[model samples]
Target: MNQDLIQTFIEETEENLQVVEESLLDLEQAPADQELIDLVFRAMHSIKGGAGLVGFEEIGELAHYLENILEEIRQAANPKLPDDIFNLLFAGIDLIRQMIEDNDLTAKSVGRELTELKKAIKHYQLVTQEGSSDEQTIQQQTGQKYYKINLKFRETIFETGTDPLMLVLELEEVGTILASYLNREQVDDLFHLNPHLLLMNWTIFLESEQSLDKIEDIFIFVKEDNQIVIEEISEELEQWFSGGEETEKLLRKEEFISNVDLDQVLAKQEQIGESLFLQSKTTKEETGQADKQVRNLHKQKRTETIRVATDKLEGILNDIAELLIAQSRVKELATGIVGLDRSLQSEIVNSFQEVDKLIRRVQEEVMSASMIPIGDTFTRLKRMVRDIAAEKEKDVKLVISGEDTELDRKIIEQLADPLKHLVRNAVDHGVERPEQREKLGKPPTGTIELDAYHQEGSIIIEIVDDGRGIDKEAVLAKAKEKGMIEQESQLDDSEIYNLLFKPGFSTAQEVTDISGRGVGLDVVMSNIKDIRGNVEVFSEKNQGTKIKIKLPLTLAIIDGMIVRVGGERVVIPLNSIVEFIDASKQQIKQVEGKGLIVSIREQYIPCMALNELLQLEGSFNNLKEEPTGVLIILKDDQKQIAVQIDEVIGQEQVVIKNVKENMGQAEGIAGATILGDGNVALILDVPTLFKLAKRLKVG
Candidate 1:
């Protein structure tokens, strides 16, 4: 196979398998839904075709077996898909996914899974037979019903190379045809007959337990070219001659019979659309619209899209970053020339401003190119939640919103592990068993909502679960026992919740496969922090726990307000700053152990001198002394605090350089950015700054 073709096959096959898995889950809820059954069948069919083209014989065979079961269901009048069948299907999907992941082609690698799936399929065949027998038994054990199938082939059917007799032979495979009438009223004499045209029509009385779908399949090849209809004439066949039965054609797109007057019969057979509407428990229009949407979605998927290697995107981003750095340098040089003509200086500033605007535009375009929807990751986590909840014997449902929210591909890749950990922990430890939840007046099915959105120039991912909320007392006790906190220290709710992120501080009584070793949450925190992000935990006992993670929009560049703490210059992301305030001693009042709270606009906001928070030498440090200069009001979402700074040194777009890559993560610092004057300024992480301020006041 061509390498590019093989790559496309693998990617497409993976996507089809995901659709199969998700559709299978949906099928478990509505086993009789024709659309859902068709969806699974089509997905498996697609995978089989793709795998066969790529020479993945084992994968193709496995997918074909699964597809066969779906085909049987689709053909049956009613399909009873027990939980075990769905389980088998899910197992098969997993096996296929593993094969694709490993790119396994050897027979030895796929033989075992293939055998197991074959056995499951064989068992499914037995189940389908039993289901059919049970249906017949419920119908009073009657031998069989008779269906009158009449097919009137158009005169051009022979031109279309259709053989009407072959369709009769195919119908015989489904049932016993007691009588077949060849309607040739419109046929001319042999001398004037067109040998290339079809003139005969068939009216057969078929008796069998087969479904309409099976009977229809026999004539599917010529359904559009012929007028065929089938009607249930089980007991009415004898009455049909007495005007008691409704006789219809096998296919009914147009009128075919003119001389044979059958006024008692209905005009046409029931359409697949009407049958699907009845089976789907939805309106016919809605079903049709849903199918249209699915087709449109597939059409969009088929629309040409090329996959670019991640390293190339990274290279482009790095170049953009360099361009930003050069742009900053030019701005510095534009203003540095002394005794220059005023017009020349203004023109230079204007030119650099335009360059800056263009550079920002390019930066945004590149970033957008690197962004991908988080829905795929969400789908994987949903599967994990389902499997883990099953293992733990807990009933759980994952509700996902904002799945189309896009984020940097690299950040999303790093986010996968942490997201998985959070979901697993929620399913395993947070949600209660069905009985426990019922006793607690909660629904037996626990709900876990995964939401993502943009806020304050960052991405906020929240995992909220209506389970047994975090036990703050238990967390506090765990921290004390682990020697992570002073036993006498009184911590607030937020402080207690934050202890869950401390290394090796778990509240679980014993370790399990899912969590409880205290490693997961800390890793989640570490991973988020690695990308200049923060995780906040909120919980109310017996209610639920909501974990909100805030991450930067992109790691490359940011609009920052440059300020000087003392001799040290720092950059604060412009999105986080609300305003600047000047305060005298009257506005700042010390509240004993809580330190100073500045009253601004009738709201009491915490105040921390920048020098004290960073532990640096500054002009202002002592709270007892009258505070002066500008107090920058910084708010990160709901948390707000006033930072006493020397002065605001204007704002500029800064290219972010990862400080941890060289200097390691520093407290209260997000990353470093180059200044117009060529000096390096540390970008302050607003969330971290709040924590530091709290600590400084507590001390």
Candidate 2:
């Protein structure tokens, strides 16, 4: 097999598996839905056929059994499915996924699990068939019909190890082969022939009571490489064959066709093949070449786009970044030149401006291409919640919103594990059982909502549940018991709730598969923070718990407001800055020895000197020393704080380079960027700065 063909098969199989997983989740909710059943059956059936073509026998077998169960259900023989059936099917899905990932088909690897699933399926099918005798009887009343199948194998079919004889054998299992015509005129003489090449076509007249879907399934393994045309010809085909002399039916002794008629049809097919072959052989070589060129041009016109590897796109971005840095340096040099011609300087500025615009446009296009919807991650979470709920014997419904919202590919890739942990936590610890919920006058089915939306150039994801909220008392007791917090520590409700994220701080009575090793939420927080994001929890006694995470739009670049903190430069994200103000002495008042509070728009906001917060040398320690210090009013969602600075420089779009990799996460700093003058300025994390200011005020 070609490497490209293998990669394409892997990508397509994974996509179809996603559909299968989603449809199974939907079927768990609406067991009687025919469309959902069909969707799942089709997805699994496709995977089975495709995997067989690629020689992944384990995946093909798993999908085949799973598809069989779904087919029985669709036929109304298994109306009241047992809950265990879903488990078996889910196990089949996992088994197939693992096989695809490892590319293994050894019997020792998946034989036990495969046997268990098949056993359960066979048992259920037997029981269901016993009760569905009447349905089977009605199905048999639909008499057998004849189908004419024309199969022309692609020239390269032998390369894929596809034996046309196997397909014919499969057809024989379904019905009687009345007559057949084999076209082998394309076969060359033994001296010139390619032994591994396929040069034959087959036309078969088959009589079976099976539906067209079943007939199509016979050739599903080779249908893509072989042209298969199946049509119902029970009525019209008889008249055409009745006029010709037939011959002996070597394969079947059925009365459908006599020997004389079969011989006559074979003779006619040979004459037709010879005439077409001779006509093609006599065509001028130039004319044939011209026709081939026209076909190639037509194919090129049809395919307008092609897939490019991610690394190639990353290379383009790296070149663009370098170009941007050089552009900045040229602009800075242009500004510093003295005694230059005014017109030439002006043209240089204009040209730089135009280049800047073009660079931005290119950056946007590349970023847009790199973005994909968060829906795939959301779907995976839904399946996780469903499986966990089933295991825990809970009735839960997951509602998702803003699934079409797109995010940077890098951000989305790291998002899956964190999101999975959060959802599993919700299912295991937050949601109450049906019995408990009914006693509390709530709906028997609990609801968990997964939502995502864009806010101020960031993506906010919230997981909200309608189960019994976090037990603050239990959390506090656990913290005290684990020596995580002092017994006399003064903690508010938010602080108490936040203790859930402390390492090894779980309150569950015992460890289970879902959660309770006390490692999930802390990992969630750490993962979110690695992307320069934050997660907060809110809960009430009986209402529920909500975990909201805020992440940046992208990892590489952002628009920032550059400012001076007593001669040192720093960058604050533009999205977080509300406005700048020149605060006078009287407006800044100290509360005891704590930080200053600046009055803005009739509201008092905590004010801290940026120099003091960052603790830098050669910085103003006192806010009142300056006649009128600049105050940057920053907001993070609903919280606001003021950072007093010496000067407010202009804003610019800066490329963010990670500082944590070298500096290891500085306080009040998210990352660093280069100024136009080639100076490195630290990017301030507004949320962290707000928290620092609050601690300063409370001290």
Candidate 3:
């Protein structure tokens, strides 16, 4: 088999399995939903066929039995599968996923699990098929219809890695094969034939109680290029299965089977064999080269869509970022030509401007391409919540909204673990048990809501649970006992809640497998911050706890406001700045216990000198001494702050480069970007700066 075909099969199988898992979850909620049942059945059917075509016998066998169980549930008078059945189905999905990951199911433990699952499935089949008598009575009443299927596949069908015999075998699984014939008229002598070309056609008389739609779906992948005709035949033709001279005569008379000698054709096919002989005749390298050529040709024919690796897309984005920086440099150099003509300079400026616009458009499109809806990630969390709730013997329901909110694919990938941790924590630590909830005058079933929406050019995701909220005093006491904070430290509710993120910090009385090892939240905080996002917690004693995370739209580039603070040049994210204000010495005043405050429109917001926050030289020692400088008001959530800068150097889009790897983590800097003048400017992290300002007490 071709490597490309194997990879494509794996990718497609994984996607289909995800769909199956999601639909299975939905089916539990609406057990009698016909659409969901059929959705699952079809996905498993596709997986089974693909697995067989790829020669993954274990996957094919497992999917086949699972598909049989789904079919039983699908055809039942009441399509409500039992809880035990759903559990078995979910377990089967997990095994299939494991098989796909390992590419084989030969491991000792996996093989044992597979054997046990198959036995359980077989038991369910027998239990479900107790109604087969009624089904047979109904089929007798309606009379079975026979389908005459003629399959004339394209010569290049082999390149697609589809075995015509697999289609026949699948048909047999759905119903009884009354009669079958192979047409080998296109086959040449073994020495002269091309091994890659499919030359035979099949004529199958199938007696089935299935619909025409179901029969046609078997040929879905090949129907476009191949000649697949399915029509109901006379009931009398069913008698041709007796297999005698008269049966062959009848089949030939109907033009369903050619007059070729069956034995001779079988002998010729056996002589030519499958690709085994070809593989033995050619060197490994030659066969690989041929397979590559065939795969490339097949890829060219598939123009509707193609999957590109995510790393390749990332590489393209990075190259485009470099091009933008080069364009900026070119524009800067164009301004320095002392003896250039005015007309030439104007044309050069316009050309550069046009290129800049095109590059920006390309960047936007690439960024858009890299974004996917967060719904898939949200859907995956449903199983997590269900399993954990079941294990803890709690009744918890997860409500998800704003699933269509899109984020960068890279960010979404990195978000899965953190989101899983948070959701698990919500189920484990946040939500109270059913009895406890009822005693508190709350609903028996607790709810955890996962929401995402866009605000201020950023994505905000909230995991809110209406359960037992965080105990502020307990958290504070734990912090003091662990020496994470001073015993005399006076902290606000938010600060106390933030203590949960400290490493090895837990308020649980005992540890469990889910959480309570003091491991989850700190990892969540670290992962979120690695993507330059911020997480905050809000809780009320009996109300609930909400963990809100703010993330940038993309990690590659951002619109930044360039500012000069003393001798250092910095870029503040444009989305973080509220407005600019010019304040005099009197407008800036020192509060009793707070840092410097700037009065703007009757609102006194905490003010920090940019130079002091970043500890840059050549900056004013105090904002009161140089209150003449401009102040950029930055807002995060409900908190607002003012940072004093010497001057604003206008705004520009900059490509963010990670400086942490080279310089290690800095206090207030997110990353660094290269300016047009071949100089690097540090990108300011507004949220971190806010935290730093709160700790700085200036008089």
Best by TM-score: 3
- Over 457-560, each residue of candidate 1 has an lDDT whose tens digit, in order, gives 88999999999999888888878988888989999898998888888777787888888876878888889998888988999877899999998888877899
Alpha-carbon deviation at 117 in model 3, angstroms = 1.4
- TM-score of each predicted structure versus truth: 0.76, 0.82, 0.85
Per-candidate local distance difference test: 0.75, 0.75, 0.79
Clashing pairs in 3: none
lDDT of each residue in 1-699, candidate 2, tens digit only: 667766766777789889988878888778866567666766787777667666667677777788777766655533555676687787888877776687754445777877887888788767756765543211331566667788888888876646677678668867887658676667799999998888877778777776666677667556655688887665544333433333223212332233445566655534533432221112111211222222123222334456677777777776777677677677778877723656677778688778878999998888887788999999988888887888999999999999999988888888899999988888898899999999989999999999999998889999999889989988998899899989987777877887887888888888997788888778777777778888888998678999998999887778888888877899899999998887664367777866577777788887877888888665565664543568888898988887778788777777778787798857678888777788888998877777666656622
For candidate 3, lDDT tens digit of each residue in 89-206? 8999899888779776333459989999999988866765575444321111134556779888888987666788888888986688755777777789989999999888788767
Residue pairs of candidate 1 with colliding backbone atoms: 228-249, 228-250, 228-251, 229-249, 229-250, 229-251
| Candidate structures ordered by TM-score, highest first | 3, 2, 1
Model 2: how large is the Cα RMSD against the reference? 9.4
Those runs of model 3 whose alpha carbons end farther than 4 Å from true positions after fitting are 105-109, 127-145, 150-165, 179-203, 208-217, 220-229, 234-303, 338-344, 583-586, 697-699
